[model samples]
Target: IFFRSAMALQLPSELWDIIADSVQSDSLAHVCRRLWDLLGSSRYVKLNCDSHCVTQRVRPLARNVRALQVKVKGPWDPTGAIDALQHAPFLHTLTLSNMAADVTVGSARAMAAIRTAPSLHTLTLNLGRNALGTDGAGALAALKDAGGLRTLSLDLWGCAVGDSGAAALAQLKDAPALRTLTLELWGNAVGN
Candidate 1:
């Protein structure tokens, strides 16, 4: 009936463009993939996706992307996602948000992988509402070895890391490339 007729008609070019733009505006990651497919090449200069989707999609688009923002959902296994980021050879900025403290053990592997990204200049991890504690901070501090990293931000607004965690993060003071550091702690105490 009407549905069949509509399906038979070819969509006008203008109509398709409208749809594509709508999709792109709705979700950055989806737009990246769609543009990649439509242009037969990659065109995304910046990208934002959850850790899981990034692990699944970023490898193919890595060569063309310059900046990346990753939001990790709670209860995540940091190792797999971190390994996926390592595959991106040209990434310059990385933002990890909503990481779970309970997953720190697996995150060690991710930390190791991040240490190897030659182009990563900025790293931000938001543990604001999760479980990352002193141990987790210690593990993240290990990234000081990443030669190109120049900026780091850690947010632990609702966690249980006290002075011990602050001490661990202080280790970054010696990082040769680190030029900026930001730490946010709300519900935790770090000796005033």
Candidate 2:
């Protein structure tokens, strides 16, 4: 097959880029050090926060990744995954989905870490079912630091978000590049 033959020939990075999509690009980069240098630094990287090997994988590529997604579930704390943001200076798009915060302190710390990524233009936080109260919502106010953020999406459904929490999120209106905003607060208690 064309795919197998191409891999056997060890084509140049440009040819690999033309033939391989993002997911396939990851595999090609691991073929050899030369390919890794040519393609790995530019590829999008994703890590499951619950993975035992995530810390090792993230530390090496964190600085080069442009788009990063950290997804977590169950009882595992996502603090370590959020901390990875500190190393990603070139990050443009970030997604932290399905994270659970048992207290406002954790929420505040997580947002504080995310605020450090100045290059972020698009951010999606899926905090649904996390029970983030008003104080936790206040923590999201830290997003005001994302100077280049253009699109923001927050899924706080069933998180017990109230009017005051909603007010806290309103602080994002000051973000200069922000043009699109999506807030999913369906099961929360926000009054008109």
Candidate 3:
């Protein structure tokens, strides 16, 4: 009796496209780098700006990015995050994470960068560390028009946002294509 060997089948590009499209944008980096390597040239990417060597890492994938997130591990300049906006013309989603009390993106440069990102439609700002005061909220509210925002999530855990700040965020709902909104304002002084 003789044994037969099994043949390996390579998946088609269309099937890969479907799989890639189904992946949640937030879960990209966690999906294993090897899988991304297997996908080769056509693999989509999201900019994850952490405390690592961000400059080198971002330059290459900047053009292909569809979504972007800036997470500060230590003291990171807001300008670095703002500069990234210029490279990603195709970017549609952005997440700015400032997990430190001393750091805030309330700079004019950052606001200008947000204005330039016409393709941006989704925004998630985790401004828990730095207090996203009413001023901060107002600045971000202007971004609601950036690419006709579709989704917005503000994790203002320690932000001192009273009625006025919340009021500003409310304007985001009036955005052109807004479909989802999340507000986390724990320990805030928002009175009814």
For residues 1-192, write the lDDT of model 2, one tens digit per residue. 644455645666567665445463467666656656665554576767654554565667666677777675454444665677665777778787665544344755575567667578889988787777887788786777777889999888878879988888888787777898888888788895
Best by lDDT: 2
Q: Lowest summed-lDDT stretch of 10 residues in model 1?
A: 35-44
Candidate 2 TM-score to native: 0.75
How does each model score on lDDT? 0.63, 0.70, 0.62
| Arranged by TM-score, best first | 2, 1, 3
TM-score of each: 0.68, 0.75, 0.67
Candidate closer to the true structure by TM-score (higher is better), 1 or 2: 2
Clashes of each: 0, 0, 2
Which sequence of candidate numbers ranks them by lDDT, best first? 2, 1, 3
**Candidate 2 residue runs with Cα over 4 Å from true position:** 1-32, 49-57, 99-104
Cα lDDT tens digits, model 3, 1-192, are 111112111445455445655673424323445435543332344445565555555556555566666565654556664676655666677776657635554552363356466677777877775665777767767756655677778787777777898888788777677899898877777875
lDDT of 3 at 27: 43
**How much is the lDDT of residue 1 in candidate 1?**
58
Q: What is the per-residue lDDT of model 1 for residues 78-127, given as tens digits with 9 covering 90 to 100? A: 66556666666666777766555455634643654686776788888776
Off by over 4 Å in 3: 1-56, 105-112
- Model 1 gets an lDDT of 0.63
